[model samples]
Target: MVADVNVFVGQQRFLRLIDEETWATVPAVDPVWVDVPVTDYTVRNRPKRRNGQARTGSYQRRYGANPSGHPSGNLVTPLYGFVNEDLEISLAQLMMEWGFADHEVKFPRSKTAEWQYVGHDNDQRHLGLRVNTATLAGSEAGIVLTLELIGQSSVSFTGAASPPADRNKLVEFLFEDSTFTLGGTPLRVSQFQWSVQRNLDVIYHNSHNPISMPKTQFSETFSITPMKSNKTYDDLRDAFGMPELAGQLVLKGLHNGTGDTGNFTVLTIDFDRLSLIDSDESGGTGAIMNPLTFDVLKPDTADNGSAMTWTEAA
Candidate 1:
């Protein structure tokens, strides 16, 4: 038996991050793209099915007699990738998606109403999914980024149309400039993580797609470490009513040159103010650091703000 020529191999399928200007319509040319070293990703369009069962004479369930109607459900996708010393170019998209105050995309996502631009004007078919949540974490083992997009049913079945021309390989964490600070003081920790999530409410209007998907609210969480020292217990023995502090995390790569931009990656996040939400002592085979979690909030000291500075240099 001959194999099908169109059968896809695992390695043949790749992912490219498309910076959509309007809804999910992928541009035909000059599309702003991000090269990602994605470990895994999936595109799912789930249909909410309806069953028509009738008992004319007896009771028997059959799998037929369905209406030729459209069913709508959530169209979702989750993209996962590994972060390295030589991080990929996905930083730009991630920064904008995370909605940094000054860097957020302000253009009309819905050219007309809330969801009118579901590739409708362009004659292309796509769902109105938007990225609502994302997470970035790093530890001794590795670094990872997880992004989730969710919205109403799609107008068409589609995935990444084409793979990026360059597939960057993962560079092990090495020769890097990384630091974590709280209240302008360094903290010794084992691991760290941060997440940004938008509270989206989708409005459906008896169709396969939504009329609007608006973000009602949003939140940001930061975990600077599993502190090796019992700074909490050592000082006060109390957890609640602790003082708030400003924090920062800087992750940078080796210096290739004075003004070079492509050889090293840079990420600097400044939290205007942070309050400790949770802290737990831990024991492990690795560093026995205290795992700490914080709720990132807007600054209260003179009304400062949070900011994220980034550079993509893979």
Candidate 2:
């Protein structure tokens, strides 16, 4: 029986401004901006096994006989050992789609001068007010942010052939489309990490003497950082053919690599933090955005067979 797998997002705290009246009326104010900490996400995988069946009285008597004694009932033995593949974590962005409104209001001027109007009281006040409000309704979507490798130790088995040729393929299968349930939603993997163990110990045992069998075990670890993908209110508007604006919508991802786990490693190839900074110089703000950390799993698809392209869900 395998234990329950556990995954968690580290704690995240940020200040959110709100209208006093609105705060009093609404249950909670939706966060306008979020800063995901560097220590907030974790993935844990474990394996389990059940006890072997008990021997019958006749079988026990037969197998328990001394070596000098004659054999009794047929001897019974346990069958099947356990085998587990690698574990992985992938991250992607999800589109939030709810709670949006746009409205306009006007204040008519009175001809009577019972009370003088305030300053800027031109002949006719023409205010072009556009009041738009929306909630951070969609799900979080983006490429796999990071991969935390655990239990990389290897154990040698005698029955199977050494050095399976499909080791890399096996790792890829475990990571691809690995989905986790978070906040009642499904999260997908965007990237993966591969840690290879160089040396492994192999043990052998003779049928006559099980205690004399030799055994060896090795350990290794790997990790990957997923990409970040959050669309701001402006991005949504533009996508829907609305006018462009100046404000930005920020999305953040938090991960924790310190818990008994090993240190997190970065494996980016082409775009580094510097390249992201350079993108800010252009008219695009998306370029300024990048994952807190990440690892290169394989060649990027968009590289025209040269590089890998990773992005959070949208």
Candidate 3:
């Protein structure tokens, strides 16, 4: 091939997932792949060098020339997309990575997502992958992956296959129609976002960036915008000094299906033992608002030892 001057576009990033036993490697066979609708993405696989230090702080800060490539900036690989098309596969992937699958099965139609730690981990839980190229897709020949984002084991993705037009519905959940509650009571709020932080630590058994990133510790946090009507006097006291572990968040999702709507999609997230991290009475404009932030943790065996539970209703 003589001097390939091929120019690629920004929207060429695509992804796919495949199951594997090893890390940083995919199967030789080209499996049937599906596309995961990734709205934003990034690729960074170049081996980052550990800067050598000078003896006794000799004012040394010189290094080799580091030139950046296209979409240049920080390194990133956490692709964001709505993994709701196949809730079964999506939550199953998370359960395998989290390693604590004590999910509640009360609701037959609704599926609860959580980690597991009793017997063996699911065989199809992890998908090992490697990152070496600084480009997404980049006109490469490969299939797409729709499997959920694997944390314990890395996400295995092939090349060049954008999400189907029908699959990529550019829609977001309406916040106004949704509901929020504190200990089951109504909470007049504006915005809310919660996240599970799996304190993952990379374990490399001599491989140059092995795909083993384990979630050693886990924690959850929640933040919500509350109006004056919702922020009561007791709520203010909870934010002072030492906060108490006495709150539960019951957040409801929207149902967007039309005909033949059986049960309707209702995503219910429940946090049993929630504590106020900080009270934000910053006094904002218009009705004077104060946002709320709280952290969550599972109680001991006395309370069943479950902090969070998310149910996906179909």
Candidate 4:
């Protein structure tokens, strides 16, 4: 028999985050386009053996036996994505589930939102998923969102038979457009990546299915390449030497419409506040580049406000 040609595309795949633990609620918006190759999934099973005694023809002998295995397993799935937008609603929800705080911001001509890290000394972070939403349009508005959901029961799939087109396709239809700014000064960027991870604990009680839930501590890592400078390099060098001196790092991404004059949509991804605890200053074989790593943290100015921000404007 021939394999079905209904391959899962970027558009067919959707990601959502919710506050409730039942895995029941689904967001109204469509999921942001995610790179499936990077998203990983796994299932582990535990098996037991049996031993028995048997009688031989001449003398009694001990023998080994095999028995049917029981259902003892855990499930794990990790998702990764690169969003070019100013804000990701699902990420805000995930931040909250992981003990972070989310804040809404209003700008003179923009709509903005922020997520702040607010866990005490140490707490395990959490994440969940669901999918539905309008396809993303325009040139530079997206935010990377990663989530991990675990359940003891079997897998479940729900969606319409004829879903929407490939979201990646729509993204490609538009032109290449994005702007990166750091501390109000436009910075040249060679590459950038956003990563988030969450894990759940699985416990087996006196039942066939296992119980799994998210852990307490979850965080993000922002990696990018910035030009080497005397002051900047000295700051990073000093921070690495003195962990306590590493201050907050800020970065932003602004997305405008496709060159068309009629289009008026604009989006911004702002990482106004983060912990700059790590840095790498390597004189590359070809071009010497200074790569920076930012560990997201709570805003130093306020306890309830946000450290990272996103904005969408007409």
Rank ordering of all candidates by lDDT, starting from the highest: 1, 3, 4, 2
1-314: candidate 4 lDDT, tens digit per residue = 99888443432232222333233223346533322221222221233355555546646446654332222221112211223243443222223223222232110011111111122111112222211111111222333333233433332333222222333322211113445565566766555554443333444465444443334334555566666765574575575543222222223222224222322223334454545656676776766677766664445665422243433333
The lDDT per prediction is 0.51, 0.20, 0.39, 0.35
Which of the numbered candidates is closest to the native, going by highest lDDT? 1
Candidate 1, run of 10 with poorest lDDT: 110-119
Runs in model 1 deviating more than 4 A are 1-7, 27-30, 33-35, 52-127, 151-165, 168-177, 233-239, 253-262, 284-287, 300-305, 311-314
* TM-score to true structure, per model: 0.69, 0.16, 0.57, 0.48
Better of 3 and 4 by lDDT: 3
What is the per-residue lDDT of model 3 for residues 97-197, given as tens digits with 9 covering 90 to 100?
A: 23222222211111111111122121122233322111111001211112122222322233334345654332333344356677667766666655544
lDDT of 1: 0.51
lDDT of 2 by residue, 1-314 (tens): 99978533222111111111221121244422111112222211122222334676553332222121110111111100111122122111111110111011111110100111122121111111111111111122322222221221112222211222322211111232233322233434343222212121111133221121111211222222233345332243345432211111122222123112232211111211110101011225553332221121222342211111222221
Q: List the residue pairs that clash in candidate 3.
A: 15-145, 16-144, 16-145, 17-145, 99-116, 100-115, 100-116, 101-115, 101-116
List model 1 lDDT by residue over 128-216, tens digit each. 44656667667665565565656444343333344433334334333124678888888755678877666566665675555567776
For lDDT, candidate 2 versus 3, the one ahead is 3
Let me know the TM-score candidate 2 reaches against the reference structure: 0.16
